[model samples]
Target: MNYIQKGLLFRLPENNKDFSITTFLDGLKDSLSATLTHFHPLAARLVTLKQQKPPSLTVFLNPENSPGARFIHSVVNLTVADILTPTDVPSVVHESFFDLNKAVNYDGHELPLLSIKVTELIDGIFVGCSMNHMVADGTSFWHFFNSWSEMFKSRSFNISRPPILDRWILAGSDQIITLPFTHENQYINRPDHPMLRERIFHFSSESLSKLKTKANSECNTTKISTLQSLSALVWRCVTRARRIPADGNTSCSLSVSNRSRISPPISENYLGNMVQRLKATTTAGELLDHGVGWAALQLHELVVSHNDKAIKKLMDVWVKGSLLVNTSVHFDRNGVHIGSSPRFDMYGNEFGLGKALAVLSGYANKFDGKVMSYPGREGGGSIDLEVCLLPENMAAFEADEEFMSIVNV
Candidate 1:
């Protein structure tokens, strides 16, 4: 688990005469403090108990000693168009987030588990949040965000979905297991990476419908979902754009939610990571030659087979080894890792300024072939894919006819 960073852009209030940065910050701080009362783990710290027999790791929350989440307020000399109108995301957008791109989840021991930076633009506001992945997955992260916004808007602490704080451990699995590493520094290593290009490809409802229909018709099945079809399309396009050898292997790893996959099913509001990464591998030739339908079906089967039994089995193996997730080691440059989700309510996080103009990601976990999906701002079934690739590959991918034919532009 690494840091999950996202930025939400909002236009300044129309009645700007009354808008004061001091008032806004006071409201935001107040709401966030109230929100953290329910989601207390965000204010907590990770403690490595090396003296214990197993040398366990724990999330310790001490109300007296806990340093609260970090809040930063910054003023930038930019406008809404500076971010929303660009096909390529501006490099300055990354500055909206806290400079914790190099920090992994274990850094929570000394650092804040959650940090929010409010950037006041010339005509808009960008609220960026960096949350330790060990504290929550996308669902839980959004849950907290939505709650905070709800409280801010309503001026009350009541939220529709209160988080379930009880941690879920497998029935037979050990509650405490030793981590493979003794120190957090072992996880921090800087590696030279290619100059990557990040772009958000918008696919309207009509285009997504066409893609889903084409994929289902080709496969002669309705089991493939819109997300699976979209993912398959990007995988194929990226593989071709990269000019990987036909015999070369490529894989698509999807971050799957395990809330429903568990036996009794965990609540949607569970406040922890209930997600797992599942990968489907195939040669470039096989994936491209068979078309998007074949690729989608492969993903469909992969997701269908990850049932409760499979989840438990994987957890058993993980508990035995206790291997912490390292992004550099786990991610493959040639393969695509689809993260975030279109299901998250990105556009609905309206504080007092109304709906967000757009959503952006931070620099953490960014590498070639990293794809973050968000529900389109217009709602409906449309999707916005924030894709990161090597500069040359991105150029080729944008020029690929088959891939561009379906883009909404």
Candidate 2:
């Protein structure tokens, strides 16, 4: 697992007004411990292998070594309606979540890999989880959350599915030259700038259908997917809003799950990071002049191009250390990252209360031009997008005519 931090906020409605805060917190802590018994790596520490070849680390587990997941209780005077007001949601939640400073690095054995902060609002409870990306990816992180929720709901030690902890499933290749390893090293210590901001945009199902229809019509084919259509539309809008040089190359890269792409499918229950980043590049001028269909076609081509051979080629590049640094690629240059599958079922986190009203990530503008789309909580065929951008670019992007036409504030 790479060094990454993923945050998820689950909004439990105020219908549970009778539930006491102390009882809620106690129940969550107990359920989390029970859940960790099954997913124990999260409670353990990483042991660095400084003398080993390929430079790796392994999770060291023991009864005494567990720095149990951190739990914090907070009270917010705002109502759930205020938190979901669209304009105020992003900055407000970002300021209220877990400690961003502690999330960056692992100090061998101190930092808990998983931490939960529950913010009690006048009308709801915000369950925020900060997970170390080094331990799991979004899929695995959610698996832990769902498992915890199951234990909370059923009060049972048995989980529906167990995660496979074999990190070496894809390891074991011949030694490679050290040169390729150096490419990712350059961007490892990159500095963080604080001028960036995060915001969410909603596109109703009707808007998504319109976008797909326009994209498909332009491409003279009906095969364009909703993701490709939306990615193309957003890529062009953000690129134009940024006002990059007309002839300069603008790129859109997607983080795709590689679970089923391998020769033999990896189980959805197979834990850890099983995603690969692939990209499509086009000149800014061409993108600006083209319709949604042209943009969709570029993305469509990028998706179809990633077969087994391409994945193997990517693995070869990664091992040789020539693959662009994953952290820097999505945030730097003229690149825009678009990810998240609508099928993730984020709205289903019931936890004995009613389903969540909304889901959000932790507050940091670590990356500009990054976007994550999720299914709407209301069960309409709608989509919710979480976007991070520089303050100026975000202002321009919010005012973008084409983008505004499709999104519902």
Candidate 3:
């Protein structure tokens, strides 16, 4: 094998030979990035030294003592050619565990960079690889991707610097990070998704504007951004659409961007894991406190606050794992799980292939789904979103008027 003169290559081990597929995928995620598709090998940029050595287990608290640790995952070398796209050939179908197929989700011909295509090459047992945005943000991923191809095809190539995670989030000074979210403990029951799921939805700018208009009229609040209003409206609609008991309350999530909000302002952009939730409470009391507009306003305030102290407070507590954000949807006992935006834009990503036609994350019918909404190039006024929710909710949503107004669906 050729040496990656400048970049790094690491390896790790799986302590338990019986590591389940889920465990293997999750473990790979800690190391691999969702933006792996954007990166490639580079003799010069590559660090010839292995990244995982001794194949040992490594662990750390998530600042909140949130069972955070690193594990080693091993895989065999493999290659594929028939799998390449007509427009472009996939450099390596199995370059790493980050490329596993079973781990990825998408609705079209393109790939969800966040997923890895794990192939069971040998037996019912499988070796894994993955692709997650944070493993390599779009910018960094592309840099590495191009670099590798450049290295193999050319004599040498210069690679860009890797993305940093140090300042991704700065917890709120006033923020509290206590476990077993007592406040929302009851709403935290995990919904079972026995089957794997995938889904996609597209909206035009005009339709999105219509939805915004409806939200503005219904909530009597102009302070809301499209996302805030949309998220709020969606939460309510999803709950109603799915026939979920509204009396129990619900939580809609919105991931906040801390680009220039932090002290250091994580300036480098590649594949951003620089995302955290801005959860909205949908309980009647919460609605009364903020006038039912709580959800939409919560998002609007977070995005526009721009207060140094407020931003600092958020980041500080998050680092310490004491960031307390309770949403009505996650209002169950012990805190239900909810994830948001796998924020993709890094260094104005424009894959000579043209900005991705669409981007999304999360598994369908798997609890509340994760979403990613980014501006489309060529002046598509509508914001694009990707989601995964219960099938019943999805069907009901498709049949609702408010839902239609939210996205003009």
Candidate 4:
């Protein structure tokens, strides 16, 4: 399990003499406690049952021993403008999150499954959350964030969409499959990553619509979606920026949600990891020459073919192997991995201070080609792509004429 780290920044309302940091934090902590009552797993610990014939991992909720969640409140001299006005995300933003920057999800056995840090800026507040990927996926992560915000705003225990805590498993699969690793250290390997730069490229609703229309027209199919169109655009531009050899193989991986792909589809509120990474590979030359529409069609087709049967088959194979997901930042320089979805209401997570000014990600699962997508702050159908690349590649990517034409600075 890898930790999914993200932060939301909000500027404090002006001309308000009734603002007290102590009161705000007290409210946030109290609401978090109430919210955790419903999301029990976040407050629980994951333990390895080595006593079993083969070591297995299980979510352990010990009322007596479990330390609920770690909450830290810190004051920073930075302002909202320091974070929002930068063309490149500042390194200080990483300090907003807890000290689990390199921690894998398995560390939740001893670490807090959920760690929140409320960094008080000079004129704003930054709420950072780090959740164990083992406990949830992107969907569940945002669900918890939204629920916490709702609880804080309403000052009540009632949440609009209560989480469905039931864990999903294949019918014939063993209840506790053997884990591939026995000790936590077996999962603590961290390789040195190349120096990379991260930039959030904003694509407005109109730009996205134009891209989608162009892609669909080029592929002669209306099935290509806005997200796919955006992914295709990034893929092509990044490939070109990397300057890969003509015959070099490059791949694009999209994180696909399994909530609706299975039979008797699981609820959207399912509070666990129900996402699978599907990759479409091609030669770098082919990808760049094919145009955005062709690349979008390839992604669209990949998503369309992953139906209930395919999901079941994949689940069956996974159960037999019981391979734990590696959260390390290992990637081919020529490959692109897209995570998160623009459909997530990142900007709607209001914790009474107001809507978030921007959303930022922590230093986990970030490599040369990592991409995290979020809905634009202004909402509508706009999308924000948090693209990570090598410094040289980033420079080239930002300068690409075709890519910059659609990007809204």
Candidate 5:
């Protein structure tokens, strides 16, 4: 049986002067084996007993095909750094940044869809997580993290039982449901490379709170939550920052955790992709005018609208059968990002070594940029946003007067 799970990659700068490939793998293997056992005993047994399948594994085992137990598929990416002093956290931890200058081309079929090439650079590190959009959504990624951490630390991992759906069950449903795959002129060739940008922004708790308040007050609306506000703010900021025209074609796409939002939340903690995109757009002036709060309401509606039965039917039809193969509709738009709550507090990313000093991540193809909403520094009131963007765009943003006024554009 051949199966491939997209790999998520990250770069960790060399912290101390020492690192051992063999020793690190040793700890990771036992840890991953333990986690698989704890999380899905059956799957773990299949693996341990030489049953469950991994792409790295052949139907028949060869010496090289043996399962490498580490949940983390890792490697070392080396680069030249600017200096040779004792590395600090940012220097060591963020060395991923330096290696990012390398080329990435996911133009053809490949497995472990995501990968991290960690390099020791002259100035810093280059970090990224390249994965197939199918293997795991944000939530599943964290599940793997939590489980991996528990196993590595040799601690009891108490995981909230994830709802399990046998693939056969979904297959049965297909017999009764037909999805709309072909419409008149339905398939438009996806752009060769949409103008997707990568950016990361940082905000102190105070800035986030004030921004939320400003969004609410300006829109004359009260229902705007922090996420809604922030998303809208980012939309506006990027539009203005990138000098995208007011009438430029764009969409603000984000995720709705079907966990609590749906009638019978689909699955509590499944290790697979379970998410829908909420893509909404507005004229630049309208976006800037209603500001974050109003745009947030628009966002709310886009998602709620999908809750109807017809939409579900459409999805069942659209995603049915072998009609669809691996697809990553990577967009090249100037100002869109997959924004999310980093959910760091949940990932017990501890190895036998220690708590991870920092987590550096990026995505595949042209998803423009990415934004992660994380807990604030003090653990209360404040919110922290880690934004990843092109250095030049960032420079333009820092210097733009109108843009600075929004944040102070």
Candidate 6:
């Protein structure tokens, strides 16, 4: 199980006076209980199999073995308007929005794999979620959310396809084992920058189209995608903003989902970490000398290179404990990690009160060079980026001439 942590924050509008906090709390609690009834693995725990020959851990989903998901309710003094505004770009709301430390910093065994916190503000309510990456990936997590919301609104979980919880659908060598909770050497420490901050950047479809054209023109090829174009542009801006040395090695990595790429294709509903990181590396000078199109082509080629054979090889390396998954590794301000998908149904969580005012992330995303995207607030083909970087670099990035030319204000 990969011990990575992920979170989501949903903002609900002001409640009617008749709908008291107690009423809302009761609804949330009951809905969660109903949700667990279907997704029992979420309410379970990862117990160590001390006596097993392979020294493994398994998920125990019974009432006696699992204590259920953690639920928290609280009220904040801030109003929705104060935090959810254009001026609040690099939003500082995640830390105050939810307690991430309790989830990510847990000792895997003693804590619930899933936890939800409901914070009531002066004008609205926010729901923050923290789930262990070992148990669920983004798709599985959102699938659970869709089910929960369905149960909340329709009073039942009648979704067409339910989650398939078999961890080893593709049987491998006996020595191939799941990454354990004790193998905490996966993450690499970042620089001790005291003023790291996060900001949201919006790129309209038109803006993205213009960027795509510009990138293609630079490469003299029409092979790059909107995602590759945007990623290359951001990578350039961040590298330049940090003023890294010419010879310094700079890298950009994108998290690629392998569910569809595997040999026979893994079911979309099959729950596990079915994702890999695809990275492109270059020296600061090389990247700076090239146009956005050139950088985009590099990323495009990197993504295209991960064929079926490559994926299988990567999987083999993973099982052998030889895969150097440096997704969390920050290399001297020279690396940027891009994740999340614009295709994710972020704004669709209606929960019976209309769509969410704004969907957001938690403190886990506050690291430098972390970029995540979802559909824009106005919908359509627009993209909204939740970008995190050092405060100084962020200022330079926000003001970059080329970036400003295409970035939506």
Mind giving the per-residue lDDT tens digits that candidate 4 earns over 211-295?
A: 8999999988899999999899999999999899989999889999999999999998999989998889999999988889999
Candidate 1, 163: how far from true, in Å? 0.8
Which residue pairs of candidate 6 clash? Answer: 90-198, 90-199
The lDDT for every candidate, in the order shown, is 0.87, 0.73, 0.39, 0.85, 0.46, 0.72
lDDT of 2 by residue, 212-248 (tens): 9989998899989988898898899899889999999
Candidate 6 stretches with Cα past 4 Å from truth are 1-15, 50-64, 86-92, 169-171, 175-194, 322-332
As for TM-score, the candidate ahead, 1 or 4, is 1
lDDT of 3 by residue, 1-409 (tens): 0100011121222243643556545534432332232232110011111123432221111222212112234444432223212222122322333332232121111323323233432222222223332233333433443433333332323334443434333343332223333333332232334332233444677766766676566677676766666666555555565554435665555545555666665564433444444555556434433422555666566567755677666566554554332332333321122333323332133222123223322222233444444443334565545444445555676667755644532
RMSD (Å) of each candidate, 1 decimal: 1.7, 3.5, 13.7, 1.8, 8.4, 3.5
Clashing pairs in 2: 4-133, 180-321
Stretches of model 4 off by over 4 angstroms after superposition: 51-65, 181-184, 327-330
Which lDDT tens digits does candidate 5 get at residues 1-409? 0121212222233464465546655675555556555434223111112223221111111233323222333234432333222221133333233222222212112222233333333323332333333445666656665556555665454544443533212333543332233331232233223333333344555676776787678767666666676677666676666666767666677765555554555564655556665678677767765546677677766766776364456455654532322224533356455544644453245444343323444322333344566544344444445454555555555565533443420
Clashing residue pairs in all predictions, respectively, total: 0, 2, 79, 1, 46, 2
Selected candidate, larger lDDT, 4 vs 6? 4
Worst window of 10 by summed lDDT in candidate 3: 1-10
Regions of candidate 3 where Cα sits further than 4 Å from its true position: 1-129, 132-193, 213-222, 268-272, 284-295, 305-307, 314-366, 374-379, 405-409
TM-score of 3: 0.51
Every model's TM-score: 0.96, 0.88, 0.51, 0.95, 0.65, 0.88
Question: Which has the better lDDT: candidate 4, or candidate 5?
Answer: 4
Ranking by lDDT: 1, 4, 2, 6, 5, 3
